[model samples]
Structure formats: structure tokens, C-alpha cells
Target: MDIVSVALKRYSTKAFDATKKLTAGEAEQLKTLLQYSPSSTNSQPWHFIVASTDEGKARVAKAASGTYVFNERKILDASHVVVFCAKTAMDDAGCSAWWIRKRPMAVSPPRTQKPLTTRVALSLPICTAKS
Candidate 1:
């Protein structure tokens, strides 16, 4: 589908069917898309945490509490949540901690490739510290 079509179809959902969930294939596709999504200077300094299980979602919901209280219910109701995190730094070491040490080519669909090296930090659903 075209970008305009996709954009037009997108809307913010305050409520999500609690019983509904994305299939494994659908979840993988979403992850791949987020990984390969373009960024300025190809910095690719982002990491993603997918919370699909009840325990995982609860953890995210806990972080969403307090100042982000309004997002708690929406997060719990959703089948899954993707927490996109930006690295504290964009240097080679920082990238290596999450992404490849060497510049790596973006992987396309159909083939599932392990694109990153390792995760440096635990999943923080709502990171509020100033950069």
C-alpha cells in the first residue's frame, strides 16, 4: 500500500480488544519493519522491546504508572506493546551494544535474520530522564 493510504488508515486507539492478539507472523513483521525503518544519518541507534505476555505487559504497565498513568490501561488492554528505546549515545560502542559492530545491511522479509549484537540495558517502558 502507498504511504498516503497507510497514513490515512492509521488512527490513535484509546481502547483495544483485550482478547485479540497479533499472530506470531504479524508480530515478527512489525519487529522487522521497526528495525529496518530509516533514520537520519542511518544512526540506527534504536532498540525495541516487545511485550506480548501478561507478565511482560504488566511490567510495562508498571512503568507507565504515575506520570504516565493514563497509558496504563491502554497498555494492559493491548495484545502487545512495542517499546522503542534510543541509545544513550550514538558511538560505535553504543551501537555495538545493541546493533552490529560493523555496518550491517538491512534484512528484508521472508528471511528472519538476527540483526543485532546484544542489548545493553533492560527494557524501560517509559524513560523519563532528560537527555
Candidate 2:
């Protein structure tokens, strides 16, 4: 479909049918699509958590309930829920190396090695594991 059609159809869903679950294949496809989603600077600073099983969802539900108690059920019953997390700080975790490798201008001069600007996200995700 067209972008406009997709945009128009997109809306936040409040309720999900617990009985209806996404197949493994469908879940995989969703993950692949999210991975390829465009982001600023191609930093790919985002991490995702996919909860497809009851146990997995429960873990996510616990986190959601701590804050958004009403919205927790949406996560509990959804076929699959993806939690997107953005990295807050760049450290020796190879984030600087990654940026320097990807962007030539990010490198500092030989005379003076300067730290690269770090990107920070507002909130951290409770789940850090990838699907």
C-alpha cells in the first residue's frame, strides 16, 4: 500500500486478543523490519526486545505495570510486543569506534584526540535482550 494509506491506518491499539498470536515467521519478519527502520546518523542506537511468550510478556508486563498499570494488559495480550530502547551514553563500549568507523568526519585530528558527541535517550528500556 501507499505511505498515506499506511499512515492513515496506523493507530495505537488498546486491546489485543490473547488467543491470537503471531507465528514465529511473522514475529521474525516484524523484527527484521524494525531492525531496518531508518534512524538519525545511521547510528542504529536503538535496542529492541521482543516478547512473544507468556513468560516473556510477564516480565515486560511487570515493568509496564509499575508505571502504566492500565496499559500493561495491552502488552500481556498482544501477539508480540517490541520494546525499543535508545542508548543514552557512548562509552568504551565501542560506540565511539562505531561512529568513527561509520563517519570519517567523526575522527579527531592526530594532534589532539577529542571525544565524539554522545547521543542520549530520555528513558531506558527494562528489557535489554534482543529477540
Candidate 3:
């Protein structure tokens, strides 16, 4: 089947089949599929902390304004809980400009070893892996 067709068939199922918890093999299969999902510059910055315990799921739910009925209820029943986070050097986009302005200017003799300007370097691929 085509990519669009495959994606269309896949649904965001919050309500799960409570009768069964995903097997290890089934979970791994899902992980493999999730890993292939589109990422910026192939930067797959996702980590899975599978919460199989009631307490773990409870904490996750509590963290979300204490009404984590979804996570608390479904996460425990689900196969895994994937935590997605992206590494960033700045707190916000505005900080990027301040970062560039800090660079020293050329004084008569142009330094040949100067690193690339920040704007040009943004073209580099995004960080895909942590550490």
C-alpha cells in the first residue's frame, strides 16, 4: 500500500483493547514503525520510558494537572509511553540573534580560522541523537 494509504489506515487510538497488553514482540514491532516516522534531518530525538506500573502511570497523569485520566487509564493498558524531547542551545528563538552578535569582528587582517557564521551553519542537519 502507498504511504498515504498506510497512514490513513493507522488511527490515533486512545481507547485500547483492555483485554490485552502488548507483548514484547508486539511492542518492538510498533517501536520499529514509530522509528521510521518522519523526523527533521533524520533527528529521531525520541525516548521511550515504558510505564507498565500503575504508580508510574499515576505519576505521569498527576504531572498533567492531576487529571491524567487518559494517561493514567490508557497508558497502563498501552504497550509503551514514548517521551519526545529535542535538544536546544537557546531558551528561545530571540536568543539566537544575541548569540550571533557576540562574535568578534574582523580587524584589518582576516582570520582564516574563523568558524562559519551562525546563519550559514543552521543549514547543518539537526541533532538526531542525544549525547
RMSD (CA, Å), each prediction:
11.0, 7.3, 9.0
Rank order (by TM-score, best first): 2, 1, 3
Best to worst by lDDT, what's the order?
2, 1, 3
Indicate which candidate wins on TM-score: 2
Can you write out model 2's per-residue Cα lDDT over 27-105, one digit (the tens) per residue? 8899999989976656677799988889998898888755689988898899898888887554544554555656677
Candidate 1 achieves a global lDDT of: 0.67
Inter-residue clash pairs, candidate 1: none
Give the Cα-based TM-score of candidate 1 against the true structure.
0.66
Query: Model 3 residue 83 lDDT?
Result: 54
lDDT of 1 by residue, 8-93 (tens): 99998988999999999999999999988986545566789999998999998998877889999989989889998876544334
Candidate 2 — which pairs collide? Answer: none
Clashes of 2: 0
Off by over 4 Å in 1: 95-131
lDDT of 2: 0.69
Model 3 spans with C-alpha error above 4 angstroms: 34-38, 66-71, 90-113, 116-121, 124-131
